[model samples]
Every structure is written in structure tokens, then in C-alpha cells.
Target: MPHTDTPPSGHATDLALLLTLSTLWGASYTFIRIGVETIPPLTFIAARTLIAATLLLLWMRSRNVRMPRDRRVWMRFGVQALLNSVVPFTLIAWAERSVGASLATILNSTSPVMVFVATAFITRHEPVSLRKLIGVIAGFVGTCLVIGPSALDGLGGQLVPQLAIVAATACYAGAAIYGRSFKGLHPAAPATGSLLVGALVLTPASLLVDHPWALQPSVRSLMALVALAAFSTALAFAIYFRLIQTLGAIGTTAQAYLRVPIGVAIGVVFLGESLPSSAWIGLASVVVGVAAMSMPGSAIQVRRV
Candidate 1:
């Protein structure tokens, strides 16, 4: 299929979608942090996927869109689940059990960098441009700045959990690239299917390990889980898969940086947190990086196999 969003207004719409995606996913860390306080990682993520899948399924039905029935498509959905939801979600949830959300956010925000590395050395999905290279570096530096110095204080430490977050980031990169194939389907198809597979994969494990029936979760944790499932996973996945088609993997993954500055700004505006002087500089860098990434010239044509 050809790229759909090519006009100037389309670019604006795509950027707005990127911002919405960033905002939804940016708040996910806090939701996960709160949900995991009482809900075990496996159960937390299993429930998240299940709830999200159900919501997406309903949305599709409302739109009269039927999911694909092919076994091959379902198989690909299984792989996507592992890359995008099952493993990464569980790893981040488990890692957050021991690490702070800020650190995890900074670490996982490297999706664009990872995608670029894969594009350079592994996937070779697109050409390596100096503009994009600079964008990746600038965005990463800005992410670090927006996250503040305190978050990096634990960089070298917490080796295991930190590695988990890095691993999750890599999975996200892989998922973004793989998601390109689903462009043939409605965005909701892959999102719902993958989450369905993820829920199926994790539900049994969650039951065996967490024995959720016996646990008493706090109301706060339950609320957090609901928000994480509905907005972060369901709504965010819809936006993500759509962008994967319109923006290509590397371009869509620019949200990895955009979210940090935006998230920090949210705190300043709504949560009464003070924005440091460095955050202003970080915001400027992030805007430049995202613009470089999403420029019409950067759109890639996939070499279909």
C-alpha cells in the first residue's frame, strides 16, 4: 500500500497524533508504577492487555470493521504481542518494581535510537541520513535534560532492572519495524489482535504466579490499572499502529523523545512541579529532533518482500 498522509495538512495531523501518542504513553509510567504497587507484574500486564484488547475489539465492532481471519495474520499477531506488549510490558512492570519511574522512562525513551541503530546495522529499512542521526542524538540529549539530572544518578547502578528497561526499549524498536506489515489492515486489527494474544499468553502465567484472587489490591492501584489499560494501552496502541503506517517506524518512534519534554511540561502545568532551566533547552532540542524526524522527506518506502 502507498503512504496515505502526504499533504501539508496531513503532516500537521500526523504531528498532532504524535503528540497525543506521546501524552498517552508518557502517563503510562506513572500508571504502571501505581498499579504495580499492589498488583504483581504478570497479573498487572495480563489484565492490562485483556482490557485493552476488549476495548479495541468493541471499537472495531462499532465501526463495523472485521478482524482478519487468516491464520498467518494471527501468527504474526503472536510475534507482535511478544515484541510490543507481552515481554516489554512485563519487563517494564517488573523492573519498575525495583526502580524509579523516572529512570525507567529515560531508559525506555531510547526507542528511536534503537530503531536508528537497527536501520543502520540490521534492518536497513531506510537510508542513514545525517539529519536523522543528529535528530536522534539531539532528542536523546534533550530527553535526558527533560528528565533532569537526578534521574541519571542511578545510571550505572541498578544494573539488572536498568538492563531490563533497555531490553524493553529494543523490543519496542523491533515491534515498530514489524508493525509496518500490518499497514494492510486497519490499525485496530493489529492492536487488538496482538493484545488478545498477549492476554492469552500472560493470563495463565499471572494466575499461577500472582494468584490474583487472593490478593487485596488498593483502590488506587485498580484505578491506575484501568487508566493504563483504557488510555495508555488501548488508545495509545491505536495511535501507534496508525503512525507506523503513516510515518514509518523510525519517524513514529520519535515520540520516544517528544514524550519526555511534554511529560515534564504536564507536571509543571498541572502537578505543580517546578520546571528547571534546563528543561526549556531540552524542549527546544526535542522539537527540532521530532521535526527532523517527521519531515516529509524522511518518509521511507518499504521494500516489500
Candidate 2:
């Protein structure tokens, strides 16, 4: 496949999809935080995947889209599900036990940086250039500034949870790269299949560990779980696969850069949270970095000797 150093043009629809995805996923942090307060991580993740799988499967059936019968394809979907949904969801849910939603959102925004590094070093699926390198660096620095130094007060003690979030983001990057294999398949097919696999794996674990049947979850937590599954997992996957097909892995993962600001705004309005002046400045830097990274190489001029 021919590679473009940056995202392709004429992507108004893709850009809209990116924003929609960012909003859906940005709100997920809040949902996860709320749900995890009452629901154990494994149980919460299992419920999320099962609900999302049910919704997506119903949509696929309504659309008359036939499920792929190939066993090999299903196997691939299993891998994608583990990386994209199961692992990351559980890790983030667990991490939220010790971290605030806004902090977790800022940390998880590292997904784009992970995607760039994995593409450049491990997969070699895209060309690595100075522009992208600088963009990634700027985005990371901006994220740090957004979180501010005070957020790091517990860094030494909460290292484990923080590392879990970082690992989860890395899994997301890997899943984005691996997901390109499903390009020829309908977006809904893989989305539904992956969720199904995720649910299958998580159900047993949740039963054994959390024994969700015995616990009494609050109505608020239940509603949060529903929203997380329906919007963040099901609908988000559909948009995600479409973006991967149109934007490729690196471009698709760029939504993470946008998620930080959106997540913070959602927190402020809905959760009565507040951000410092530095966060606004950092958000501006993130926007500039993402814009620079998304531009085509030809759009940036160089003088020849």
C-alpha cells in the first residue's frame, strides 16, 4: 500500500467523524469513573462489551448485513477485540479507581503519540518524518502542561495505575494498526464481531471475580454503564472502523489529540470540574500540534539548496 506522510485531503466527512468519535470517547472517561465506583472493573467491562455487542448485532441484522462465516476472520476479530476493547476498557476502569476522569483523559490522550511511535518503529506502516516527530513531542508536552505539575503529586505512589493507563493506550495503538486488515469488510461486521468476542471473554471472568449477580449497583451507575456501552463502545466502534478505512491508523488515532480538550470541556460543564489557565494554553498547543501533524507533506514547504 502506498503511504502518505500525512492524512489525505477532502476529508470533511472524516473530520466530522473524528470529532464525533472524540466526543463519544471523551465522555467515556466520566462514565467509566462513575460506573467503577460501584461496579468492579471486570464486571463493568463485561457489561459494556455485552451490551455493545447486542446493540451492534441488532443493527447489523436490521441492515441485512450477513456475518462473515470464515473462521479465520472471526479469529482475527478476537484479537482485535482483546486489544481494542477488553484489555483497554478493563485497564482504564481499574485506573480510574485512583485517578480523576480529567487526569485519566489527559493521560489516555497519549494514544496518538503511541500510534506514531508504533507505526514508525514497530510496524513501519507509515513514513516517519521530522514534522510528525515534532508534532508528537509537542502534543506530549501539551498534555503534561494540561495536567499541570500538581497532578503529579501522587506519581510515585500511584505509579501502577498510571502505568496501566499508558499500557491501555499502547494497546489501542496496536489495535488501530491491526485493524487495517478488516478494511475490505463492512465496518459493522468487525465492530459487532469484536464486541462479541470481547463479551465472551469477559463474561466468565466477571462472573468468577466480581459475581455481579450478588452486588447491588446503583441506578446511576447502571445508567452510566448503558451510556458507555451504547454510545462509547457500539457507536464509537462503527465510527472508529470507518475512520481507520478512510484515514489509516495514524490519522484515525489523531482523534486522541482532540479528545483532551473535549473531555475537559465535558467535565467542566457536566461534572462541575474546573481547569487552570495552563490547561487552556496547553489545549491550544495540542490543537496546533495535531493540525501540523495532519497536514500533507506537500503542504509544508522546504527550500532546496
Candidate 3:
């Protein structure tokens, strides 16, 4: 499979998608924070995956697309779903129970950096230059700066949940690289197939563990759960696959860095959370790091954001 070409509009579409992805993802923390308060983590995740899978299936059917029956394809889709959705979704949900959404999101922004690091070892196609390595380290350092104060503020710090978020990001990095194989297939096909497998794998476990029927949730919580499934899981992927097709993985993953401000803004506006001075410094560092990392290898220039 060939590498996805850069978007036709050059960097403009990339920037736009970056903004959109960041905003949607940033608000995600707020939504998860609210939903988890009312619903159990596993149950909430189950509902999310199930609803998203159903939605994707219906959308595919509407387009008259046939599901691939090949065992090898199914195997690939299963692995993609486990790495891209099921595992990360469960870990993020569980971690959110213990950590703030903003902090979790900041941790999640490490995906692109992970990709840089992972590709250095695994992928022969992409070159890893010293500048790129510096950018990767800078990106990680910036992410830590953004979360540092909150993470270290109190005793009994949220070390576990923070680690969980990092782990989840790594899963995504692995998925992004692995998904390069899907370049041969239509983006929507693989995305829907993965969602289906994710739903199938999660359903039985969800029933056994969550038994959602047993717990009563308020109207708001129920709405949040539905949104998580429909918007976060389904719509987000729909756009993401399109973006991945339009822009390469590095371009798509760049959205990770942009998501921080959106998450921080959502926290401030909706949750009334305030950012400390250190967080601002962290934000600046992250922005600089991401900008440095994402610049075209030829230019190797940093522009003010």
C-alpha cells in the first residue's frame, strides 16, 4: 500500500481538520466526566461501542457495501479494533474515573510522539532524523509540563490513571502504524469492520460485567452515554477515517497536540475549571513542540502559532 498523499489544499485542510478534531476531542473530556458520574465505566463503554458499531453498520448498509468475509481480513479488523477502540476506550474510561478529563487528554496528546518513537524502531519507510528525535522528546516533555502541576499537586497523586492514559495513547500509536495496511481498502470499510468486531468482542463482557439493566441512570447521564457512542465513537471515527485518507497518519495524529487547548477550553467553559500558570507554560511548550515536530522536513522552520 502506498502512503496517503497530503490533502489537496496543502496545509490549510490539515489545519482545519486539526482544529475540528481538537475541539471535538477536547469537549470529549467534559462529556466523559459527566457520563461516568452516572454510569459505571464498563457499562458506559459497552453502550458506547455497541451503539457506535450499530450506527456504522447501518451506514454501511445504507451505502450497499458488503462486509468482507475473508478470515484474514476479519483477523486484521479484530486486531485494529482491539488496539484502536476496545482496549484504549476501556483504559481511558477506567482512567477517567480517577483522573481529570483535562489531564487525561493532555496525556492522550502523546500519540504522535509515540508514533515518532515507534516508527524509528519498526517502520523502515519513514526516516528518523536528529531533528525529528528532538521534536519527539520535546513533545513528550511539553505534554508532561502541561500535566505536571495537576499530576503532582497533591499527595496520593493520580499516577495510575496517568499511566493508563499513556498506555492508551501507545495503543493508538500502534494502531495507527498497523492500520497502514488498510490503505488498500476504502477507509470506511475498514473503520466499520473494526467497529463491528469491537462491538462483538465487547458485548459479552459488557453483559457479564456491567449488566447495565440493573443500574438506573438519570436522563442526563443516559444522554451522555448515547452521545459518547454516537458522536465520540461513531461520528468521530467517520471523520477520522476520511481525514486519514485525505491526510497521512502523521497529519491526522497531529490533531493530538491541538486537542489540549480545546480540552482546556471545554473544562474552563463547561466545568468551570481553571488552568494554573504552570499549565499555561506547559501549553506553550506543547504547542512549540508539536509545531516543531510537524513541520515539513525540508523547511525545518518554526513559525509562531
Q: Give the Å shift of residue 224 in candidate 2.
A: 0.3
Which lDDT tens digits does candidate 3 get at residues 1-305? 32223224355655666567666666666667778887887777777888888888888778666666789988999999988988988888888888865567667877987887667666733545555556566666666665555654532378888888889999988887777776556556677888888888887887898887788888888888887777777777766766665554555676687676666666678769777666777777767765655555454332222
The reply for model 3, stretches above 4 Å from the true place, is: 1-10, 64-66, 129-131, 144-148, 154-158, 278-284, 295-305
lDDT of 2 at 60: 76
Q: Give me the candidate number with maximum lDDT.
A: 1
Q: What is the lDDT of residue 252 in candidate 1?
A: 95
- Check candidate 3 and list the clashing pairs: none
* Superposed model 1: Cα runs more than 4 Å off: 1-9, 298-305
TM-score per model over all chains: 0.93, 0.90, 0.83
Q: Relative to the true structure, how large is the alpha-carbon lDDT of every model?
A: 0.88, 0.82, 0.71
Top TM-score hit: 1
| Worst 10 contiguous positions by lDDT, candidate 1 | 1-10
> Candidate 1 clashing pairs?
none
lDDT of 1 at 116: 84
Better of 1 and 2 by lDDT: 1
How much RMSD separates candidate 2 from the native structure?
Answer: 4.6
